[model samples]
Target: MKAKQLYTKPAIVGLTLLSSLVLSACGQSVESDGNSNNLANIKTTTLASSNLKFSEHYLTRDVRDDVFYFVMPDRFDNGDSSNDNGSKTIPESAGGFDKTSNAHYHGGDIKGLTKRLDYLKGLGISAIWLTPILRNQAVQGDSSGYHGYWPLDFTEIDPHLGTNADLKEFIDAAHDKNMKVFFDIITNHTADVIKYQECHGDGKPLFSTSKQLCEYVSLADKAAGKGYTPFIPKGHENLKTPAWLNDPKYYHNQGDSTWQGENSIYGDFMGLDDVDTDNPEVVKGMTEIFNNIISEFKPDGFRIDTVKHVNMEFWQQFTPAIIEHAKTQGIPQFFVFGEVYSGDPQELSKFTTEGDIPSVLDFAFQYRTKDVFAYEKGTDNLNDLFSYDTLYNDHNSSADYLMNFVSNHDVGRLAYTLDQSLPEASEQEKIKRFLLSNSLMYFARGIPVLYYGDEQGFTGDGGDRGAREDMMPSLTPDYNDNNLYGTDKTTADDNFDVSHPIYKKLAEYAEVYHGHEVLRKGTQKVIEHNDEPGIFAFTRTLKDHPSYTVIYNSAKSAKKFIAANAANHKVVYGEVNQQKNEFELAPLSFVIIKTI
Candidate 1:
């Protein structure tokens, strides 16, 4: 299952000849200013060009119809026990590789996920998105970087997760099943390592100095003896594995972020040293790092982390560079999406239109769906959310690429959120609401992402650690009964049950979604049903394909509706009482009908 076994290496002479011919045809030339010849620079005026054609050697994978299943490697499953405390470089205690502590590593690795490919494929997932696997700081502050956000080495995979070969095998296994794999990556900052000198009560507003602190010196005022000097630990100055990032100048050396305006973009996030993305040197350094990863690993796509914190100019240059690099390596349609973390359409659209990123996680969709279905808010809000689609660069394509989900690692679980929103509702009603919300996400426009453990009915109320609970016997032999934050509000089922009502419903609908191209890649038009309160309706249509209409009644009472178009329509999925032109929808239910 090694990568070499999966794809044969192309002859060097042939690749060079093909690249030369392709560049000549495009009226462009590749130049190497020298670090690496393969990492050539292409001069192009626009990234969006119809005239530009790549060499026939370039491979392409279209992800427009993909259904992504997001999993946190350490919290998903553990297929290997020997590597539980795997790192030889860092001590085990400092590495925090204990399963009992929720903040520490719980032994899930790539091998574990690879072993469960059948389970995932059976659930109808077309793609898998995992958090970063690069080496991370053993522990940061009071907890470990078990979530894989605090990167220590960009080039090497963490031993705790397994060797590079293990990762290659995982990807190979997934590809064998016709499933794409996406790696989550970070460029905003590294683990908290470099520090600054503490400024006393000068009323200058200094961050807490409990950890090592390096004096902050403005780049412009570093010579006057009035500026700050970074305090790098002995042997740790060159800590990042890729030698280029070892230089102190690569970091901003600024104080903690106040999260007010410009500082939010440039300052350190949660004490992690923010890279000076504006610096040409830093930009070149990161470009080399990611380019190497894409060329070596050849993942299907990337889920960019903390993209909003980086400068827009950096992305404008960086994104195109990565795409070009991938194309040179014979990968034409390498997909990429950013995490904007905003529920505002206006804010999110800027990254796609102005920043040049292809797509972004649909925070606005997640917000509205949670409000309406989980909180029992007016169903009109769902319609209102879709109305803002006009703000995107290409509304239709944007909807097709946007990553839609109910809950993720950073937020409260959907099950827990529904319970808290309607405390008096019975368990059956809560399950119904959860299923209804998921239906909207899967059937609506855009790619749907299911967070791990959500199908098993896991519930956690607070953010971060609370939401990321272990995935039952699949992840670990037994559930970690205590929540990381000790909220007592969080809860999870100890047993992994594929027969759960929600799991069964999701599997059924997944078959429908997979079989119908119109549902996967079609334009949606909302069908207004203002007279029927708590009922939402929409039609997904594509030329040359039969149109499908979807209806959802969130009301506690059954509702009836009549549509002449649906009179002779066939039931594609879901249950509804139909009689010629009239259809009766059960309480808290949904139905999918196809036009004859």
Candidate 2:
């Protein structure tokens, strides 16, 4: 028997929960420069998310439909250069290795981000997820907290990244722009220094060494005599352990190791040390930190770090407390998305169960898409990869909650990865693939997230440090090269050559996404594909509206596709002449069509 169709309208009636929510219209509203820098403008306004429309769907279960622009605070624009605090000479203890000077902190702070809210707002970005901002060890050259990941004190904001007041202003400015902020949180591990004393060449560790190390008492084995936790290095004779980890308050230690080695969590991100979320103290401290962030930052949502490393029980206890605490502050709606970073559908599904968390990064689908893009398989992998029935029918959280992206900071840049084999692919060809990938990201189901510099055709060869580069204003003057198509090119530190056609094309794509809800809320289907010639096309349809079809010519030459009985459709993003049924799609070109 065929499955029953889901009705568009709700069968049950219920009163909306938050009465204080001021729902706005769907059009774009510009924020005038009206003393935005002054703190006086903050409290008078709903500081983080006021301009855009907030639907019950989003407010109810932390479902964010808006496109997200993920920013690396230090790498993005540095608005307040005055706040540069670290030593100019890089320190040995930092997370930055010699290869990546861009990862070095240039002291980009909350004020800096706030100053550039207009830039993000103009891009039609509704959500912003900044890297971790918790207090971190401030050793020069130790790019730890500079990238916002080496968390020291969960309670305090990094002094180098500005003060609590600056954060408030940032949130306020973002709200003024109708943008939501997602705090990149880490309850998984503290600063990476195992023996801070040895690493820093000092007796005193950076932070309190004792409180950093905590006793190990499992939730099931709550017995106090279970003994202190020890850091055991794998396959090593010498156990390099922290001497004073018994005290629970002075320093925070990742409680336990994950049962599965590196790949259990997000396979791509293994730099993070796994914490035992099962310990009661671990649970308590994490809950307190989350509550503190909610009380202080008033973030629209949280992107929980390394969530799968922790036990299911920890989420069972922690998420509710965080959400409940936020509701009392009159911030009735609290959104939470966890990073379960597993490509296995079953593993990702485990983290999305009820009461566990509302949403998770769709690593399963994302990795599959990345693989398809890398392998040049067109849409061949999409069908088996995206188990829409299991996704929609399973007992996990709402399907809309999933976050999807083709490339992120942790992985190889899409442009860089795609251009590896086709190294000499023409500028137009490179731009073609980039634009097509982005169109897919936007029109596809789930919340789409764009990395910091993906819009400008940024290229990164490898993972981690390689994937991250400083966003320079433009290509540096010294280096110049021409591709197979003989187009002039220059290399800058991850800077955009705006003269490149892709940047303007990205602006158009962003405009389309920001202008229409159909891109975010529409249902999608693969309309056409030719396996032999490597051509693929898909269509997205909004409720009772005209459908939009996206076609791509993945071949090296222009290809013609015959759409039988299809008439009067205008190609928007791709190369398609208006003359007749026979139209050519340029190599690596992407086209979007809407029924006239």
Candidate 3:
């Protein structure tokens, strides 16, 4: 199915640029003498903190002040080939490490990620969110568990990735640098270890299709629990760790989900078994499991997987338990965000409000700005998205903590989104639009997440398997064939080139992000957006301090005027869009100005 059909946002995939906009050179630099690197311009004012509102969520400034780097372990780097194939020896046919296929593992492990901490820290990523590293079944079917989502054992790290000690070392090293490591955890489901008697062989399920046909059955239809007879595959009885998972009663055992209605919660996700999170036993067991995980690893946070699929009641109990346990484990500000792939603010905020999760991944941000960043849609779309920010403004959670990103493992990279929107656009134009997305996220309200390969400009085919590219080097033709922004090097070559345009620009953006308190913890107010693809702006201010107006020109041509009041402003980080004045926002560029 097409991404547009799957996601609520229609403009996400294959969006065209707003009719025939010309690509002009962004005029002159708007800097003053071109020698101002005053990264820390925030006045040391105790008065600002004193006048701050008593918002529990905003008082301490936690992950809201952070910039994150999201990584997939199997695609980052392979520091040790010894752990590549898990416990399987040399003759074990590369042990699922088939570098050529996008579906197979490529040997990037915790150790590889550990070795690259400097690379991440240097780029200004305060926290690292890695895809699930918990032990997977390893090669469930044709596709291997390279992405780390298929969990056979939740208690240990997958042997193909590394050992428990290797993970501890990685976290320890990250902490030593004052950086954080957040695990991508899942309570929604385990690997597809259970099979139903009704779906086997000639028995013929009620809704069997060419791919899968375990049709979703309601308990109301069959009253005596799961509609199908679920049994473990003969030899794989004890295959799953945490042993209690062996019971069929622990799972929903309904059927395959077409991702509609009740199936979204009970149905199997792409054949992976869906756990019955609503069950009291399951809730208690999952909480204890993760608590033990925190007790053992002592990591900073969790980026929960398939969050919306679980019942709200489960999260209400689970999230607070996890946080309190983490505090007991000495991680005071342990942040947790769930993955709810919806574009609606109401849908995303519900997890934070009723479910007790601190925040959910801001798919709404990506949906609203996917076009605005590239001038395909007006910035008014952003206004529409943020207009509902108060929907997330409960006492424990608010819009400030939403994990903002334009690109991700499931939705492709930022450059990929821009390139897809404007296929005929130049690489230079693509790079500017990419930076524009970063500029908004970096200086705007929520936490900005720099997708793993985005800094190196990895624009793969589109979402999912295509979006995942190897950072180390490639043996895959699908990855090698795609175009990388700024650099000619393909995925067949090492992409750790810090000299790349996107990398260097983001590094500078990081310095600016780190130095400014307003950009981090400030109250954001969106200025009026252009009706067409023109100047998009917002203001970030902390207490009584000087407010910085952030301006972005999404137009193909330079903006002649801006709606925001930028008259008494001086460029602090970027060049002004206007040739003479600091007020005008430039085309395909962004400027941050301090009110003088």
In TM-score terms, which candidate is top?
Answer: 3
Q: Model 3 over residues 45-94: C-alpha lDDT tens digits?
A: 11111121211222133777677999998999999999878766322223
- Once fitted onto the true fold, the runs of candidate 3 whose alpha carbons sit more than 4 angstroms away are 1-61, 89-94, 201-210, 224-226, 561-567, 577-582
lDDT (0 to 1) per candidate: 0.69, 0.55, 0.75
lDDT score, candidate 2, position 499: 28
Residue 40 of model 1, lDDT score: 21
How do the residues 64-137 of candidate 1 rate in per-residue lDDT, one tens digit apiece?
66778999988877778777776866652235777666677878888989988777765667789999899887
Candidate 1 colliding pairs: 195-213, 195-214, 196-213, 196-214, 196-215, 197-214, 197-215, 217-228
Local accuracy of candidate 2 as per-residue lDDT tens digits, 355-455: 36878887776666655555566566665555452543344365555787777767657766667745554444444455556666766667778887675
What TM-score, to 2 decimals, does candidate 3 have? 0.87
Model 3: colliding residue pairs: 30-576, 214-256
Q: Tell me the lDDT of candidate 2.
A: 0.55
Query: Which segments of candidate 1 are over 4 A away from where they belong?
Result: 1-61, 90-94, 199-227, 395-397, 472-496, 529-533, 564-567
Ranking by lDDT: 3, 1, 2
